[model samples]
Target: MAELYFLIYVIVFIVGAVSGLLYSYSIHLEPFVVKEKFNIPILIMAIIGWIFTLNFSLFSMIPSFILISIGVFLIGFVIDMRPGYGRKETIIGMIISILIWLITHCVIL
Candidate 1:
C-alpha cells in the first residue's frame, strides 16, 4: 500500500512538472533558461508534501492541501503579474506541491 502511494505521487509529480513547463511556455516565461535553478524549490515543495503526508491523516490532509495549493497559486499568479519580476517559478512550485498533496491524500490503502 505504501509503495502504491509512492507510485501515485511520482506519477502526479511528473504530470505536474510537465504541466508547469507547458504553462511557463504558454506565458513566455522561458522555463528552460532557469530550469536547473528551480530544482531546489521544487524539491523543497516535495519534501514539505512528504512531511505533511507523514504527519497528518488523509481526511485532515485534504483541506490543508487545498488551502496550500490555492495559496501557492495566488502567490504565483501575483508574482507573474508583477511589472518587473516576470518569473513563473511559483507556478512550478505550486504544481509540485498540489500534486504531491493530492497523490498523498487521495490514495486508498
Candidate 2:
C-alpha cells in the first residue's frame, strides 16, 4: 500500500512538473517552436530527483519520497512565480509545503 502511494506520488509529480513546464514555455515562446528547450531542465531535475531517490532508498522510502515531492513541487511552483525569491509567494509555498508534509506524514506514517 505504501509503495502504491509512493508510485502515485512520483507519477503525479512528474506529470505535474512536465505539464507545467510545457505550459510555461508555450506561453513564452515567440520566435520558434522547439521541444528541446522544454526538456532542457529534465536533466537537472532528474539529477535532483535521483539524489532524492537515493536518500529515500537509504532511509524510509515513504517519508523521503514525500519530502522529495514537496521539494520538487516547490521548485516548480517557484520557477513559475518566484516573486524575487523572498516574497509572499515563497513564504506561501513554504507554509503550504510544510502543511502538505505534515498531512502526508500523519496519513502515511
**Could you say which candidate leads in lDDT?**
2
Total clashing pairs for each candidate: 0, 0
Give TM per candidate.
0.35, 0.36
Q: Superpose all Cα atoms of candidate 1 onto the true structure and report the RMSD in Å to 1 decimal.
A: 11.0
Can you list the residue pairs that collide in candidate 2?
none
Question: What is candidate 1's lDDT per residue for 46-105, written digit by digit as tens?
Answer: 445444444335446476544444334334333333233224444554466566566866
Lowest summed-lDDT stretch of 10 residues in model 1? Answer: 77-86
Q: Which residue pairs show backbone clashes in model 1?
A: none
The number of clashing residue pairs in model 2 is: 0
lDDT of 2 by residue, 36-99 (tens): 3233343344444434433344346468757667556535533442122223343444555455
* After superposition, candidate 2 runs with Cα above 4 Å error: 30-91, 96-109
Displacement of residue 66 (Cα, Å) in model 1 is: 9.2
C-alpha local distance difference test of each model:
0.47, 0.49
